[model samples]
Target: MDEALELGEYLPQSFANLNEQTYLDFLWSALRTNYEAERYEFASLAFHLLYMSFVSFSIWQIRLARPGQFAMAMVGFRSEEEGSLLDCESPFKFYDRLKESQIFRFLKLIGCNNEQVGEFAKFVRRRNKIAHPTGTVFFNDQAAIDEEIASMMKEVRNIEAHMQPVIRELYHRFLRDSADPEEREYTVLGDEITANFVHKNYMSAADIAFCQGFDIDALSGEPLHDAMKDLHDALVALYPAEGDVEEAA
Candidate 1:
């Protein structure tokens, strides 16, 4: 007999109240449960190991690439091209800009708060190390590795438990709230926004054209200015101001 059958046989009468079909269902369910747990554990271990390797690799890359200069350029801390050395300084400038960005706002709407987004960005950066590397040697530190893996597994489980319901609800709402045509438009718009912003300059002219093919004015048969005003109002309502900060006097 299979281990599952043997295990089922050993169960007490109360535990075995499941019918034959239910027993089969329980067996399959048990297999799936084990598989998911093992898969998560494996992924967690892999991620933790990758993160450790990333820390080492990132340090090396920084030394070789002189990424400090790149970071400085990105944040306008120093202007090597403009013959200026670290003059402009505003710590919150980048944060403020990110707050205003459409992509960031969308992410915020989908329950990924600023702190969570920062952690996700770090995870992506770590993932890049492995992706960009030609080769890597696996280092064994069993105890530490195991602990890191456990922590990662817990974190992943926590995230899934917390976010899965919210995501499901959002998906259900989208399906219910939108008509077929509106759903198609929303999907196209989402794809376009992702390709335009997330993928940077990777998209071709054809791809750009495909994304921009939808003519909102033509579809709605409304003036462009009126459509824009409506869009602005919707956005403002979606992401309302936090406090009673008065406008500049």
Candidate 2:
């Protein structure tokens, strides 16, 4: 009981304005939003991680094939204390560490075509916006909310179209080159990788597409489509419609 009372001392003075039930309501809302927000954030992260893994693997292969070339090209990424290397493991951090132009140049060196390099930059930028904190509140107007949803779906499709083929080709090439003919998993490597990644990471269809030989169209497939729709509906319900806000006002 004393510990509980001590915890109360840390509560903000502004919270005193709210009744206890209001506090409970706020807690419940936070709980709901936190789950939904995490799911949404992680959905994007699935794609981001898969993309990073592909790039990292390709970079490793480049190092294996031409040790001097990869190192020489990465000189720009080097800092005063650090040598030319992408220190961060995550795609977003790798992107942040290097200038956009530098990243594009490095991608070219590593075998990404001009179009693939541009698409990758765009995809990473979108992922960064999603990952970073933005103080913008949810739209209280229905039309605005609809617009926001449309924007999200468009971004989703953009990521799908641009990154899927690139990732597919990368993994396909990797497996083709790296897999041993005698290994049992050689023939089913794609399916094995897809299953493991999806099970372990709760990866979205987009994440699995590279290994599964699918595309953004998979997003509209049965299980994924229903799951995505449920998440979307839940998120939409969290925001107040224009009429509801006016009524509250």
Candidate 3:
């Protein structure tokens, strides 16, 4: 938005009477929302939803960005010849069954080591406890709440560490491998990846937590890489740079 305002200054004639102050704070609305947990159970449940959504979104992206080999392999048919008509079933029947699936095996296949896989699994049991009904009583236990949040973040790190590199490598290959004839299909691949992350919401705050599961920094690298330059050119066309943001006097 700030980027648009700055550019709009130079293009005043493009839109009659548009000014920097015209749509100044239109990025978000005036309504404010706040949630406070006075009960331990409520806090636990709230955190559970936040943490789960983050992880789930990440997994969804992985499924979308997967290469052909690993994509169909998650269906448990990667090793067998064609015979079963039920082969079209989704590998993830539901998000709840993620822990029971061959997710760890898939992680290893995608180049993540056992430790990274194990670290991500460390919180599933705890998450399950809060996600389902149990005879356990609830109290305002600060220490336990702290521990759960810490563990959830630990799992977040494992996902970023183990999963992102896989996407990066595949994204790079997509840019280079499909370019024997022209300037390359980097834009095509970039759009495929970006469209996966495209969000239309105009809100802020907790939305950042939802970014954990997807092809975020996967297509990125130090500015030194030629692929990074190509990817930047593709992305900058879509999202204008903040460096261009400046108020016109």
Candidate 4:
């Protein structure tokens, strides 16, 4: 959070060895680095990644929870010959297809409070204004930037807390239903659940950072070593082994 903090606190040495820098590194650098002269860019990048992850992964959670009719279409399927079954033009296009009405319906079915859905809509509107500016002044000063970032973080944390129990219960049901001897065909559903439900969705600290334009190598330094360590611990806590879905069998 400090303007001059070093990445040594968050990354590990092996981060340097990654073949190609990824969106994860981009976000990690933005969140962990305090580029003094680039404070505005750093704050914006960190906030954007956090907001983006919340929206996309929230939808991803829905796709995981409701594998019924529409959710299946959203999650799509990949085959050796057929390729992408859903034919999404782009990520934003995909989001448009999911839309608020669809997302709210999914949330209601999953027992999410109506108030939370309203808050989510408000947040999306705010994100739209930020992502596509029309003379909107985002931050007036360093203090304001920090305050806004903190506020967004609070919202993100609240959403995560609300989702945790719901997702857990749904997953338990999926596992239980999949394991019924009379429901062996449901095993494919389990496969779809596991294949589509990325574990990274559960661990915010380890969620991969993604953006449109950024140079990966130019962003690396000794500081990233510590951030990577923190991420590793987060992922380990979420899943100690690869036996997650299969173990439910």
The best candidate by lDDT is 4
**lDDT of all the models against the reference?**
0.33, 0.41, 0.42, 0.43
TM-score of each: 0.25, 0.35, 0.49, 0.48
What is the C-alpha lDDT profile of model 2 across 86-196, one tens digit per residue? 343333344455554455455565455777667555656766666677864333343443443344444334434444444454433333333343442424443433332
lDDT of 3 by residue, 1-249 (tens): 122122122111111123422422221111011113345555555454444434444444354456454455456543432222123232223243444334444556556677776766655566567667887744347665565556666565655555555445444444444433245432574553253223211111122222222253554563334554454455445444344334221
lDDT of 1: 0.33
Candidate with the larger TM-score of 1 and 4: 4
For candidate 2, the C-alpha RMSD (Å) to the true structure equals: 17.3
lDDT of 2 at 108: 60
Model 3 scores what on Cα lDDT?
Answer: 0.42
Candidate number achieving the greatest TM-score relative to the actual structure: 3
Question: What local lDDT score does residue 245 receive in model 2, on the 0 to 100 scale?
Answer: 62
lDDT of 4 by residue, 60-103 (tens): 55554554633344333235211331343222234445554444
Regions more than 4 Å wrong, model 4: 2-21, 31-38, 69-93, 96-105, 132-136, 170-249
Clashes by residue pair, model 1:
none
Tens digit per residue, CA lDDT, model 1, 1-249: 132222222111121123523543544464445334554333333454333322222222222223344243344323452232122122112232332122122233334577764553454444445455547522233443355444444433333333333333322222233324333344543442333221222222222222232233443443344433333333233323433123421
Model 4 scores a C-alpha lDDT of 0.43
